[model samples]
Target: MHIVLQIGSEITRPTFWLIGPVGKAVFYYLAAVAILVFLAGASERVKRYTKGDADHADRLDDLPSRVVESARTVLSNRTLFDRDFVGGVMHLLVMWGFLTLLIATIILGIDMDLYRPLTGESFFIGDFYLSYSFVADAMGLLFIVGLGIMLYRRYAARNERLWGHHTSLEDDLLVWTLFLLGVGGYLTEAVRIIGQDFPPFETASFVGWAVALIIAAVGVTPELARTLYPITWWAHALLALAFIAAIPMGKPFHMLSSFANVVTRDGDAGKRLPGIPADLDATNAETIDDFSWKELLDQDACTKCGRCSSVCPAKASDRPLDPRNVILDLKTYREERDAGGEDLPIIADGGAAVIDAATMESCMACMACMDSCPVEIEHLSSFTKMNRQLVDQGDVDSNVQNVFQNVMQQGNTFGDQARARADWTAELEFEVDDARETEVEFLWYVGDYPSYDDRNKQVARSLARLFELAGVEYGILYEDEVYDGNDVRRIGEEFLFLEQAGTLVDTFEACEFEKIVCTDPHSFNTFKNEYPEVDFAEFADDPMMAFEIEESWDGAPVYHWTQVVEELVDDGRLGLQGDELAYTVTYHDPCHLGRYNDEYEAPRELVRATGCKLVEMPRNRNDSFCCGGGGGGLWTDFDDEPKPSEERLREALEDTSAGDAIEKFVVACPMCMTMYEDGRKTGGYEDEIQIVDVAELLIEAVEIRDGRQA
Candidate 1:
């Protein structure tokens, strides 16, 4: 608003009357050119901030169509939309104003001389275009107000964190400066409007007009207003120029970069994940060890909205990791490097003030934040890579040493043998061992919990019954499978995860399974998405593409128990033998199944097929509250009050439709089973509802029909 009034131009206009059109033309051109030059420099700085090490292949693979679609869904998706609107509304106003202001400046350049002489009639102003001028002025004012609110949010009110505080002095100053730029620019215009009392005042004057009246009422003569206009205008102009120039200097730069980042985002952030290369040349001497500057700087694209922090089970449980800070830290660290500040340790750097080990650990790699982010910042991948650098390439800490030792020597997170991995199968009537030698149609990659946990043993049994009833040629890896280490890798054991994934991949290479499915979503996610990258020297694979391969691999189908059960009903193969076991059950979505993989519907569909009336939880489907077993949370003890699952269970139980209490709460993940069980205990729901796996329910349905058939 201030910039448009051209208060300085009004003061200079009289002087230009003597110099004629040519001199005025030269001055406007120089100012326009100055703005462009500053903008270009800012753009370059943002580019430098996000670039990292060279990716093994193209680091980004999100397709434009998918990115656009996901962005649309982000707005509609309630979970993402809830905590986002305040920030989104403020940000959108500022962003829209930025573009509008740029266009206005370009128009000023044209008005001065680019297209017409400086003496050209001011045809663009006045009541003829009253709506346009009024809108621009209103938007400009709105932008200032938005910036004020944003600054308050970022500084005075902020979330707790691990490394440095969320609000820094520089961040606060940036917001204040941006806000002043808007206010000062508007005031300059108001001064000019009051000085000239121009005929177009009615249209060009909306915001500035009232201020002009106030100045005139104070006995400020037109000549005095004229004198003050140029100084205020120049101050406004200089501040705008400075803000433009400072774009790449700090966190505020995301305002400009977020658009391009969104357009070029990796779509697999929600639908899938990146896959490892299958043909990696382990011996490649030249090409396998580095990440590109762009790849590394990908972290810089973060808006610091803390969406990742909110969904992070680790952070929720008081773990140190915060994805927002991880990106901010890396960006700061990169900036320091560009500034010749690389020699200084990152932790000691000002940027490191926002990042640290706890913030790093708080990330669960659930990708909830990744899916929720409007700009497609890959926080999970960035954090995982940092974990790789610290635990794999750098000196290992004792905590990491302990994890690796347990995984390598013990074969699982709990330091148990593979024998325990199949211990759950012993309770079932069927022998679900490997058919690797017999062209098995399905290879079930059962993870540790389902195998060893007594409660989940029933899930193992239910799935077995469902598969047998469908007459599918599915076989288990039995004792051959090891932990997928998805959680371990996410929790800062990159090398250990690599070792575990490598062992599993090797086993797959030796065996001849047609298709693979795992009861563990983490195992499914890692094997389907991350394992191939165990060796990155050869062909680099995109995880999105890998999903297709995993879907169609070996001409055999891989299905979660839900998918298979759904197929059974679809194919007319389903036979429910049990008496109508009428019970109200509420389903708790596991972060892995619901958020990570977006497999929300299948489990519910399975629940319905059992003829049990489904009692919907308050947070169901994609927005289903997490059970808090993700990111090695099952392994971590919570001495802190209000455990995540206890909170989640309350949400689930609160949604009962009937006066009758919920008798059973079903979940799909072993981790969820563990968590909800603890939640049942903690929430004192142990006497009210039993948390059972969906697989176990299907098993009950099958056994009932089997007896009738007998």
Candidate 2:
């Protein structure tokens, strides 16, 4: 009988050799088995998430918004695209091709089993069917191309981001399985096209038609082609089933977990650190159950991309910490526990620990890892949580413990008396108003280093002069202003931070300041972001709470001095008076201001406003390198050969060495100033470079304009 070809004909392939019924039955059975296995494995992995503590539950409050954001993140691949464009494009192409093919598969199943059976006619048989066929064929080719690129990247290119660290058999399995599956699919389509008597319109399936033409030129008879069709079809079908079954078995599992992670990510990246539990002596998280559910999900969501490790300052400085390995180790521990292994100690005596203590301490809490992470994993939170446990166990570094003790006893990391807080005001030409005894428009919250350290005190004095020149109605709390506790909180001393913050909040309540401003980015970050959640009842009767401020303090507005200076220059409040100094300047972005608070523009603007030639370091803005002073690094010294600060200094010097050279390395944070000053002397760049705060630079420019010696 002559087969009739309908318009756009969906019946491109003939029935199976073992009869259509048998073929359909076998296909459905295999599909069912594959799906069951996939779901079972997925469920087991999901169950482990419940072992973690509750966190980011608020993420579910705005479900629709979260879904839209998640969809946008996935479809646009914004995180990867913005950070690594080439790799992002490769990933995007493969992702789109796979999704399109998945849709085509579902449509084909419906057309074969439901539409044709019920209507006695194929739905995908007309112009729409031809279009669908063309699309499917084109996408299949695209998928193959994407797979080839991935193979090249993994093997030929040997991408540093992918290889050279902790790769496993599972990683190879995932790539090879997908590669083989794509090849098998394309070959099956070619065999079917050659065997069947398809119409001219069906040739719109270009790749398949081309393959068929090649087969025909090879003298393959129609009968031989038909014989090969069933063999190729079965092979393709089994391979597809195997691919689906392996989705939740290994690295391929990221396909699902990553999407879920993106959807459930914390809305506020700046406020990622969870508050310490109220019980001061409460046990830290010892097991997987101790972490928040989002944190546990972080383990599964990690793509092993090594982006986190690549940007980690500690890792770059040859510290014991490798963020990628830390996450992978946690994942492995979870797998072991799920497999009925003994409860593995996260930090054991002699046995393998999930993460060693040294790695935990090595974290600088700079948020670089979190910022670089495409999946938005809370790596810093993990470090802090683990550190909290270590602290409770009295296993913290001696320097860190000393910092904790000083902050608790002396209200500052330096153990200086509260009376010495306003010592910097002594050299100011103008008598600074005391906010405690008078109302002021701006309350200058001179943080620990600016108030106590000699070098930082000079910067503090310069800032006070700038405030005066701008005619800003600002005053200091003097001795009443205790430490803001930004570093203390980060050091895993939550209770002490609370006490310090509470005392400061109370003092602010008594002061008649409209807004609080600080020269230190650390203080700026803490007051603006963290203090609102401080519980006052705990410090109500404590002697440390001796501040006389009485009104309800719900965290007033806070601004960094850079922000204030930017406003002053914009408003024409501060006039630049002196000759533009002939100096090449490079600005260092402190971690808190740049990444933690997203305040990059203001400082750079302030620098440029001074008429100094601003040369940006290779890494600036959100990608800026840390000075190793954050996370209590200022007080707690590590045995790093080239400290993070010194490393950053070298980067600046190298950028400026060729030309006019960097005359000054301008900074905005007191901690950064301290770190880089030491870096200047230690790195042997003291003759070539001088470290100064943005305020100092601005003051110099202002003084020169006034025709006075700077």
Candidate 3:
């Protein structure tokens, strides 16, 4: 009884309120110090992220498209969402709730305690204070619930990604501390309600009243409740301060940065992937030469969510590249370099902790990691830049020599005869390249595949027929066009890519064609995005010449063959011929054509216009599955394993209901078409289905109707 009475004395005395004034002064001072220090540190770190380059090439106009892309990803990659819905929703609620509660917390501090003590009517709407109270209390409750779910998942649920390094003990301690903070806050509210005689606090203080009743049932007197309130409130305030100050050092830092990063993501789906620049370009390359320290700070933006790791094809295929771990590696490297006051070593300096060659080799340059990152961290570009540093500066192991050898001797990855690069175009009635004439309307860039591969020859033939039908005069860079080498550049042969791109740009400069088009998205991406660097040396060069713009003809206004077909159909310049080729077909999205170029709808539109019945695949458009032909994977052997095409083709067949009614698989990419053909053969579905390009489908439709291929 004496202990209870002593506690009551401390609680009810006006002197207990002294803690509020003293605590406020100390806390605010500490908070200002913390914020200032963090601002300096974070600003310094962000400079490292951009590596001292203030010109962020992220292209702000691209942010909306990036958001839409991320939104599209929500449904496609449901694994991340499904596994952590409650935790995620709770997390969002807590985040949003904290913002609202922050306003209330400030109001309580300033109006209730500072402005006019004990006035009780200083709120935004004085008498209707219940609404503010309810919102604050309700959101606070949600914040607690969300934190509770997180704690449960961390300690009890055993989620692999979250606990990959087994820091469960420390993490659990943190979780418990946070939980206690919440509990103490709620208890303080209950105590205050029980002791105070404030009106308009009836139903609004539901949790407080319930907590008061519980304490009363346990034989706790009003004196005990009053005594406990001050201590608990002080403890809660301290915990919250600690949490805020700790923000810059943990994964939760992403809570503040991810939205910012997402808002600044690349929006141009049509912007071609920029290529390595040449000599004259180097003269104006100050932005590329001096990378800012902020370039290095980009590591801080990572949430370490592991969503990138889950979708990584390289990791899935048993390679060493875990994109999440790569970001972690960068973070660790940055920390050690800064702490030691030493220059970051060429190979991520650390004993027994450095990333190795085997780990880097596992990356197929797929860019899926970059695609999935919620923070828009650009892991692909970072990794490639590191590779550039490694090979050029560190003398690290690489396939660069082999790539050069292939391009120099064979002119392709397959080491096929360079002479045969234009074999498919041998039968074309028109001349391949007659730059001397200089009056062509279209410059058809017949890339290595459609020009050589017998299977892709049909696409070449269809393109010719379509051109003839449209009365579009087009020229081909037959022998003049060597490999554009975007894949080679991405895989770290930057020099070779520049040389090849340089040659292509020179050839285009000499040509008189009004417009250029290519069947290959890779070639299109290269010529349109990279080759133009030769002209402007700073900005993307326009592939379309003046006549093409005026007459709409010179630059490489590249499109998937389907997009061209759709445009032709829309203009009434082209139409489906006979009903004989009509069958239920499904379209597969190639990573380069679908995700890379934003050509999802145009291909679907073309397929629908073909007069064939169309069926939807479970993973179509931006959500489409990779056909395993991208990032030079089509040519490189993967552990002597069966082709990725076999698996992808099997998936497509299942989607098209090939066993039921579909007789053909229509594709727009030459690589995809080749892969599907191989897939059909390997999967024993050759007799069941035939794979053809959308151009071929149009040709078949037209030939069956007009008796001419177009």
Highest lDDT: give the candidate number: 2
Judge candidate 3 against the unseen true structure and give its global Cα lDDT, from 0 to 1. Answer: 0.61
Model 2: per-residue lDDT, tens digit, 1-710?
24344424344433344236878798889999999999998997888777777783475778788889898989887888756787787787778888998999898788778987898876665667678878888887877887888889889998776864569888888878777777777777666666665457758788878877887889876677778877888887898898899888888889888888888887565454677655545556588778788888888899888888888898888888888888888888878787898786675323476777777777777999889888888787777777777767677788888878877778788889988889888887779999999889999998889999999999999999889988999999888878888876776776677777777877777779899998888888888877765556645555655544333357788999999989998987877632456668898989999899899999888888888888889888988999988887777667887888888888887754434377889999999999999988887878878899988888877867777544
384-475 per-residue lDDT for model 3 (tens digits) = 65555444543433354565577766666556776776677668776555543556867777777787778888788888787777666676
User: How do the residues 48-75 of candidate 1 rate in per-residue lDDT, one tens digit apiece?
Assistant: 5344344444534656665576456443
**Where in model 2 is the C-alpha error above 4 Å?**
1-19, 197-199, 213-221, 270-272, 348-352, 538-553, 577-579, 655-660, 708-710
> Once superposed on the true structure, which residue ranges of model 3 sit more than 4 Å away at CA?
1-91, 112-121, 148-184, 197-202, 210-220, 268-294, 341-353, 393-400, 409-419, 427-438, 534-556, 577-580, 640-644, 653-663, 677-689, 707-710
Clashing pairs in 2: 577-705, 578-704, 578-705
Q: RMSD in angstroms, all models?
A: 6.5, 2.8, 6.6
TM-score: which is higher, 2 or 3? 2
Clashes of 3: 34
lDDT of 1: 0.62
For candidate 1, which ten residues in a row score worst on lDDT? 280-289
Worst 10 residues of 2 by lDDT: 9-18
